[model samples]
Target: MKTEAQFENADVNMARRSFLHYAGAGMAALSVLSAASCKKDHSKPQMTTGIDIGATGDLAILNYAYALEQLEAAFYINVAAHMYTGASDDEIALLTDIRDHEVAHREFFKAALGTHAIQALTPNFSSINFSSRASVLGAAKAFEDTGVSAYNGAGYLLKSADYLLLAGKIVSVEARHASYIRDLISPSSFADSTVIDSNGMDKPQSIAQVLAIANGYLTTKVSAINYGYKAY
Candidate 1:
């Protein structure tokens, strides 16, 4: 008994609902596509240059220190993120504090470098298994000790009093961290034969030497040219 006009009106209403449903679904699909697109971007840290820091001597030494700090910072940050096995509460707390210190060191170098600062470095941690406590603590000890040695070795290379003082401050804290990790691993590894030289001074490595050992763990080669560090 309904009029044809009313029947037509109902058909039009159904068509509008169908259209809206399809429109909403299309919008949702578009949203997902947009998010996926964003995830594909791999843009990273950029490099800047032309600020003369001198012929890679003092500036180069600073750059070397900066690079090492970056490596240490990244490693500790990773350790904190995916903590290793058998990590005690105290160890975790202390290591986390060290991680914060490394980050500060990296940032300080970056700020001091100004326009000559190297780009953000990505660490290769594949050599050390993060899931195992032995691997993590072992790597931590190596890093901390190496950091201490690097500072001591490079201290003589730094012409600027400002830089030398900074290195001393950072390495002292690094040594403390190293000792703590050593004791945790074994009772007397801190001042043991592995780290301390016969003269009782910390064993040190030159910039070239340290880079050779540490650079293997990096995916990208770091250039010290801009910072006044000569490769040879």
Candidate 2:
């Protein structure tokens, strides 16, 4: 049988391989977005106290996703910097992989958005107790769940089929992250009925709903006013 340390190393290796595969796919997809964007207006959104994700069609949705990715990335970066007490080697490896993935997702959106990308927002993790395992995993579960829902809800708002395709790809990854985090919280609870409905589908949340929950963790609020979404 493989030793615990061997398992940890294996998991970390797998995660790095996955990240490389994802990065290659992401770059290909971004190239498509770049070429497609050239034909359209590439104006930047107006800046305000809080980040305005713009009222424009696809760009608005992209910025919206970017904002959420930024929050998740920051949260995990903090978690990895100081892991909770008593965290096992397996947990550390898994969480580190998650952090790398979230960071990749964040940069992907930023690059895809290019000039239209929203500025990076400061994260507010004051409510989280990173020193406790329960607190850290609980917060991770919430972020992953919210991210999956946000992508599902906003996919339809994208005007370009290419953009929608990209969103679909990203959301699928987010769902995997959600499942992993959920299982970490409670074994075999990854697809609980609370998030998975009677129809056996993952739940989706509106941009307004997502931002309302997300902004609480962000020092800089985000708005998709053009989509008529005002964070509550």
- By TM-score, the best candidate is 2
Give the Cα lDDT of each candidate: 0.68, 0.80
- Residue 170 of model 1: what lDDT? 76
Across 93-211, the per-residue lDDT of candidate 1 in tens digits comes to: 98878876776666666655555565676679899998898899889887888888888877997755655666787789899989998998898888987878899988887665666
Pairs that clash in candidate 2? none
lDDT of 2 at 205: 95
Q: Give the TM-score of candidate 2.
A: 0.82
Model 2 superposed RMSD (Cα):
5.7
Q: Which candidate is the best by lDDT?
A: 2
TM-score of each: 0.72, 0.82
